[model samples]
Target: MVKVLQQATEVDYGFRPSYRKVWMAKQKAIAQIYGDWEESYAELPRWMLRVQLTMAGTVTVLKTSPIKLGDQVDESTMYFHRLFWTFSPSIEAFRHCKPLVSIDGTHSYGKYGGTLLLAIAQDGNSNILPIAFALVEGENAESWSFFLSNLQSHVTPQVGILVISDRHNGIKAAHEAPENGWLPPRAFRAFCIRHVAANFSLSFKGKDARRMLVNAAYAKTEAEFYYWFDIMRTENPAMCDLANRMEYDKWTQHQNSGRQFGHMTTNISECVNSVLKGTRNLLVTSLVKSTYERLAELFVVRRQMAEAQMGIGAGSLRSTRQTGTEHPASVAYNGSHRRP
Candidate 1:
C-alpha cells in the first residue's frame, strides 16, 4: 500500500484517484505479477494518519468530541465528531486574494457520514481559491459557527470582509448571532441569487416570473431593478412580497452596499464542491488529503499559466479582445479626418 501511494504521488503530487480506481489498479497489479492480496476500506483512516504525520507541519488538523472527561480518556466513549484542515500554502495564498468569500456545505458519503463545509475565495483572475475545509457532524447552527470562527481565525482577519451563502437558516443565524463574531463591523453576509430564484419558483409558477425575478436581482441600477421588479409585481404580487421580505441589500446587485464585488451567488463554492465529487465516498482522512493535494496541484498549474501570460506583454492585442467594435489600429482617417 505504501509503495502504491508513493508511486501515485510521484506521478502527480495531487494523486487524487477514486477509491474504486485504486481498488481496480491494485486488483490488476496483483493478477499480473504479485500474489493475491486483500485490502479493505476500513484501513484507509490509518493510512491517512500516516500520510498526515509524514507531512506534519504542512497539514493542520483539529479534532473535537463531546465526550471529553478531562484526563479520564475513555477510548470507547470518545469518537471522531468534527475535523477541520487547512494546508500551509493555501492559508498563505489566501492573504493575496480578494476579501470576498463564499461558503457552502455538502454531504460526505464516507464510512463516517458527515457534512463537508468549505470556505472559498476568488482570485483576481476569477479562479476558485480554497481557504479552509471542515467535516462536521451535521449542518446546524453550532457546526457553522465553529467552522466560520475557525476560518476567520486561521485564514481571514480583515475587517469589512464579505461572505456569500444560500438562505440556510443555520448560516443566517450564525452570521447574525453576536457571539459568532461574524456580524457587521467585521464581516458581512450576502444571499445567493440562485436560492432566491428557487424560492421564487416555489411561490410563483411560470417561467416569466423566474426571468423577471432574476432580472431584478441582476440589475445594476435602482431604476433597472424597479423596472424588472414592477413587472414581477404585476405578474405575481406574492412573489414580489416574498422578495421584499428578504433584505434587498443582501440579494440585489444594486443594493449590495459595495461588498459583493459583482458576485450575487455562491456558485464558486458550489463549483469546488462539484470538483471534489469523486472523493465524497472515501474515508475521512483520505478525503482531507485529497483536497489538500488537489488544491496544491491547482495552485501550481494556475501560477504557471499566469507566468506564461505575463511573458506576452500586457499591452499586446491578446488583452484587447474585449475592447468591442472599434479597434484604434483599424480606424483609418481620411484627409478630412473622416472615414469614407
Candidate 2:
C-alpha cells in the first residue's frame, strides 16, 4: 500500500468520479421510464375522462400534452407504425363488435407521411363508433385494401358480416389480391354517401343538383328515394346517363336489404379528426403513437359513459362481434342496449 500511494501521488484523475455519477443518473432515468415507474398510475379516472371528452374540453387539452412513451418508438418508424396502427379499439373490442362497416382513409399533415384509415360501426343508438384505425402514407386502393385485410383480424366472421367504404377502383383489385382471396362475398363491402356525392357532383353541377342528391339520400322510403331520384334525372339528362351507367347500383345498395348496410355518410370516421383536431402537430418522432395514446385515453372514458347509458355491466361494454370462425353466443342487442 505504501509503495502504491507513493507512485500515485498526483495521478488520482479527479474528473473520473463526477463522470461516473452522471452516467449512473442517466441510466436510472432510462430504467424508470422503461422498467417500472408508477407515473402511468391510471391517474385519469374513467368518468372524468368522459366528461372532458364531451366534444369540447378533452379535445382541447389533447393538443399540446405529451407522454413518456414517445421515446418508445423505434428509429425505422416501421415498428412504431406497426404498434400504433394496430393497437386501437383493442382486440377485445374488435372481437365483440358486430356488423362492422365503413372503412376510409384521409391524409395527415406533417413532415412524416401519414394518413388515417378507420373502421366504424353504428352503435345501438344509431350514432357512429370507431373500432379500429390505421395511419397510412397516402390514400390509395393499396392502403384501403391493406386496411380491410388487416381489419379482418378484428372480426369474428359474424362480427363484420358486412362493411362499407368508398368503392374506389382499386378495391376489387385488392380484394382479389392473393392474400385476401379467401374472404367471402357476404362479408359484404359497399360505399358511403361521400363517394356518392363526389360522383354525383362531378356530373351534376348546380345548386339544384346538390339539393336533389342530398334529399334523395335522406329519404326513408323506397318510393321517396326513387321519386326524388327520378326528379333529379329529369332535370339533368347528361347527369342521368352518368348515374345510370356508373352509379345506379350504388343507389340500389341502400334500397336492397339483401345485404346489411351501416352508415349513409363517412361523417363518423371524419368525426375523429375533429376530436383530435390539433394533436397531430405536437410530436416529432412518434406523432401517431402519441395521437393514439390520447385517443385511447379518450375512448376509455367515452366507452364508460356509453356503456353506462346502455346498461351493460362494467365489462359487457367492451363486448364485440365474434371474429374468425368462433360461434356467436345468442344474444339480443337493440339500438341503445345490449343483452347477453
What value does the lDDT take at residue 191 in candidate 2? Answer: 56
Q: What is the TM-score of each candidate against the true structure?
A: 0.74, 0.58
Worst 10 residues of 2 by lDDT: 57-66
Q: Model 1: runs farther than 4 Å from truth?
A: 1-61, 66-77, 310-340
CA lDDT, candidate 1, residue 209: 84
Give the whole-model CA lDDT for all candidates, comma-separated: 0.76, 0.52
TM-score result, candidate 1 = 0.74
Candidate topping TM-score: 1
